[model samples]
Target: MKIEGKNVFITGAAQGLGEGISEALLERGARVCIADINTEKGEQTVKRFQEKYGQEKAIFLKVDVTKADEFESVFKDAVSRFGQIDIMMNNAGIMDESRWELMISLNVMTLVRGTNLAIEHMDKLKGGKGGLIVNTASVAGFGPGFWFPVYGGTKHAVIGFTTSWAVRTHDTNIIKLFILYQFQCSKHQTLIEMQYKFCTGI
Candidate 1:
């Protein structure tokens, strides 16, 4: 699993943890597709990456991850641009208790959709090269969060869904699946450490 020359598709990559992961990937010579709902920020991020990593190292695709069709299209467009995606990172999520339903859609449903799309596109059995699928979860998923009950529940769902897929896909050991438990810390530091551990099998 060399990072150089690999193509990565990442959601919520316009800012925060996703953006940090994208930066680390690009630094390691991987081409990235930064998918996010924020068109302005996403494009801006891409521009910065392109300037630093070369004009073809990264691209931004505006995407509403909750929309299955739009999300799927992002994958297609990314593949069309990069030839293939070697890594899929489902990092789009929200922590709004006032909008719990949208939280579920973004944190849980969209993650599942993204994982499925990754499998469909990268599974060796499906006439494609195998790749890694990484889903971001919170520490709240492992326990109760009274302050943000619904947000915690969505994180719980993320953990459950990702672990279930890992178990189900054990027999077919081509495509790798992982869940990244995000902890409270400096965003870039934590994500860079976690991404290093996972990508390098350290």
Candidate 2:
């Protein structure tokens, strides 16, 4: 898509893939909202982006993806700042099995809620311009891993939700759904089975 002049809201923009993606989009002339729970890192990221790009090109909001109100606020604030949102990236996630519920809320529930909010703001039927929604998943969503099964399950739910929405919104050009799967060796068990075993005391 032509990103120039478009506005994007990304969850988990404090670090990792979300941060990288936000940087790339900003570099391509897109305004971005850096939304993440880490206030310091999120502000740092937005400051860096604004300095590197321009003051109007980036903003940061402290958002906890697991909280519906906070997550919804990101969208509202982004629209208020940028006039409209062209893209919504539901990219926040976690890999801690010890806290499986938090992981699920972070990975799956956030994406679901973000998607709903994105559609509400970007739907043509709702008197807004059309937009794109991208959900970040992991390779584990489509395959198996001996370690981090719960994390994998959360990603799987993401894939399912995105696909179901894809089908439901098939004929509509108002919004598009995409599932972005990142493949990193560190996330896969094959590259760290021994380390996993050592860490888990297995």
Q: Point to the candidate with the largest lDDT.
A: 1
Per-residue alpha-carbon lDDT of model 2 for 44-110, expressed as tens digits?
Answer: 8888888899898889988887888877876798789889888888888888889999988888888
Local accuracy of candidate 1 as per-residue lDDT tens digits, 47-150: 99999999999999999998988889878999999999889889999888999899989988999899889888877667878777888887898889889999
Candidate 2 Cα misplacement greater than 4 A, ranges:
175-183, 186-202
RMSD of 2: 7.7
State each candidate's clash count: 0, 0
Model 1 misplaced stretches (Cα beyond 4 Å): 171-183, 186-202
- Residue pairs with backbone atoms closer than 3 Å in model 1 (clashes): none
TM agreement with the true structure for every prediction: 0.91, 0.87
**Candidate 2 clash figure, as a count:** 0
lDDT of each: 0.84, 0.77
lDDT of 2 at 113: 94
Deviation in Å, model 1, residue 51 alpha carbon: 0.7
